[model samples]
Target: MNESSSRRLELVPGGVQLGTGPWQRPTSPSWVLVLPQTVGLCSSDLKEVRRSRDVRSDFGHEMVGLVHSSSMDDFPPGLRVCLDPHVPVTRTTAFSETTLLEGSPDQLRAALPTVLDGTPDDRAAFTEPLACAVNCAGKVLAGSDVAIVGAGTAGVLLAVLLRLKGCQVTLVNRSPERLTALSSTALLREVPKVLISEVGTRTFSTVVVTTASLDDTTFDGAWRLLSRTGGRLVLFGGIRSDWRVPGTHVLLDGIRRGEDVRELELGGRRALVVGTHGATGADFAAAGAVLAAPLPWTAGHIEELIVGRVTLPGLAALLNDAVRTGVDPIGKHMVDIGLNQ
Candidate 1:
């Protein structure tokens, strides 16, 4: 086999740039070389590009790759794996065609090898985002009544994962097209789907706001869906820094202080608001298991959510378009490296 050159997304002046360079392997004995097969372009990635001014290439984390070579015996070459992006080496550096992962055996243990043997690379790439949903699911009690606002990728995954866990979940979104997309899967077909205008007189034990760009009206709507006595509002999708939510800054401030739960007043009703971001190593492992295991909805779960696929250069084009229009496409867009070669 020949050594591979690396191509990655770089934050440049005016917009994003496709950067090329020689792929370097770590001299350390524990390092592993990975050839990324499929990478998901997360909303967080676009946000990072939109916010930063420096020229940087370390961005793009959701990936499924094959271990091209490994110094450690545990991770043999050719093993399919999903990387944990929280680690320094893999964080925001997954856009490349090749990646060199370096860490202690325990640290590198996050490179979980449980994407089912015959699963398509694209389907397996769902691990990272699913891990995030697993982390959020941990907050709610088992079988709790839940409402998820925003029917985007994260929101839809959250609904499916929570419903499988025995929670009564209602998926609420303003867009019927997105909701219609969910109906294709039999599992999601059972979950109650409601539009924002129709979500009246219904309250949940926990309400999760999964809209990437949250506004005041959505925030208020989420509050209304929460039970007045002890309902919990989860900020799963982040709020724009420039946007303000009335009566919610105090809760946001408390969350920044490391408080897991904060008491707040919404619509004159007292409620608890909690925030969740990213995923843990254990969550990553669990996500891998969920994908690999045989389940009724596993196929649909992995396949239905992907709305579009692009190559590395095509990804740059999408990012450029987002920069120009100030709007991103409504669904998940994957960067398939095979499309490039």
Candidate 2:
């Protein structure tokens, strides 16, 4: 094999830059499997990095790769595994990915079962985002009246998970088209629902915001969606730092500057603001477990969420379209990266 065959997509100060370099096939400890990537891509990978005024950033966190070589006892050559770009490895594990690169080793990693079975191509690539949505669902109390504000990928998945948990879910998004599209899902078809604009006089026990941009309007919308007392607002989206909120409406969590601000009660209703940086390795593993179980929706029904797929060579062009158009890919964008391609 030629040493210069390795190709990687890099973010540069000017824009994205693709570089082909030498990639060493692991030989040490002999058990480490160097699976060639199959497919990988995600919305977060396409987003602009914060404060990277001059530096380029790496993207594409979601990926399914095969075990090409391995010295580990559990992962043998040709075994299929999901590449968890977030967690790093610290110790040897019989059933886990031994060499960690993204997150700490104590973090959890999971194998891709759907891929192993050779079924849904999109499902294999969608594990990361689905796991994230599942993790968000886990954070909320059971059977709570939940309002998912954002009909994009995460919001739709959250609705499905909440329904599985026996919660009454209401999907609220600015776009009526998106809300309508989500309403067609069997997971949400029978649930209580309303567009954010149509939520004239409705409120929920919990409001989860998953939009890309968080502004004052987003806060106001969340406040309107929450019930007066014991209502909680969970921030699951990226927001601008200068976004402001009414102190009395909700308590802010993970806001660095809000430490001194006291919580306030509105109309005898107390609001709690919860902010999570991102999902942990355990969270991703838990998500995989959910995927391994009977899907919350039928395979045919869930397939409606997928927007499209792109080859590894064409990923840059598709991402460029997303950036220039300011549109979120409805379901997921699968990236094919196998050598056969």
Candidate 3:
């Protein structure tokens, strides 16, 4: 891609920049060039850009785009794809006007192809994260009472998916704005939600923590919300690297490894702990289907989660503001690549 139209979000000291540059074409025919249409701005990306002193690799995953150039027959130049970078494809960077996907035809087709061909870019972009929630939901037994700590996008999506599967879901968060935003949605209007301090005397068969805001108090709240006997705890969010949880070594280790942990005893309380990270190819495919055709009980389409949309340069400013002020904006922010271009 030429320098004029090839803009990307670059990490610089204290913030980010929307820089223009040329992209060299890959020599291998296996590489497919994609023009990103929309990308979901994840908190992890903002956190990394905030801490970095120099430009690093792309942090923009959770994207949907059209195949701009491809030698493969299956993925033609105009075909659309939703990429989950964790699916193991090489050179898969999403935070740019142009990105490359490297893999064999079969591999690329299996991992990148989507059922969301005509779906709007904003909705299709949710494939990656919803797939993650799908992966997390697969671990829980249907119809079991479940509580999700943290009402961020991840927690809200988890609550919707679990509720659709017949599980009773209660979403908990410390922030009222997030909960209020969720309630405004048509699908989750009636879903149960409470503050971390308001989860009084309530317990569930399963509890999932979906935010990185967990500390001693929040962690203790999550633990207390579990049913005393045979309850399962799913750690879906990674703990902040700077914080350490003592006396919960087993659970912490499993979270770090992204693997399941056995039952653990905490002050004579016990619950089976399970950890989940990235999504698989099958999970992506399922997520695409869920977004493309919202089931009757799905409450609302994935597009409802988008709270703000900005262009590449606008995204740079948003990151800088978050880093400078040390506070993150609520809800999902989508980067509209085609805006003001």
Which candidate leads in TM-score? 3
Q: Between 1 and 2, whose TM-score is larger?
A: 1
Each prediction's TM-score versus the true structure: 0.87, 0.78, 0.91
Question: lDDT of each structure?
Answer: 0.75, 0.58, 0.78
- How should the candidates be ordered by lDDT, best one leading? 3, 1, 2
Top-scoring candidate (lDDT): 3
Q: Could you tell me how far off, in angstroms, the CA of residue 115 lies in candidate 3 after the best superposition?
A: 3.9
RMSD in Å for candidate 1, one decimal? 3.1
Residue 222, candidate 2: Cα error in Å is 0.9
Clashes of 3: 0
- Tens-digit lDDT track for model 1 on 87-138? 5443336677777778777778765544667667776888888888898888
In model 2, what is the error at residue 277, expressed in angstroms? 4.2
What is the per-residue lDDT of model 2 for residues 259-329, given as tens digits with 9 covering 90 to 100?
Answer: 22234455456777666544556666666665554565565434456656665447666655666576645
Q: After superposing candidate 3, which stretches have Cα over 4 Å from the reference? A: 1-5, 52-58, 241-244, 251-253
* Runs with alpha carbons beyond 4 Å of true place in candidate 2: 1-4, 24-40, 49-58, 89-121, 246-269, 296-303, 325-330
lDDT tens string, model 3, 1-341? 45445888777788878887777477666878888888898867866776631223438888888778877777787787877666556764577888877877777776675646657788888888889899999988999999999988888778878988999888898778888878878768778879878878888999998985457777788888888779998888756645555564443634634666677777656898887777888888878787777657654587888889888888888888999898898889998874345
Q: Give model 1's clash tally.
A: 1
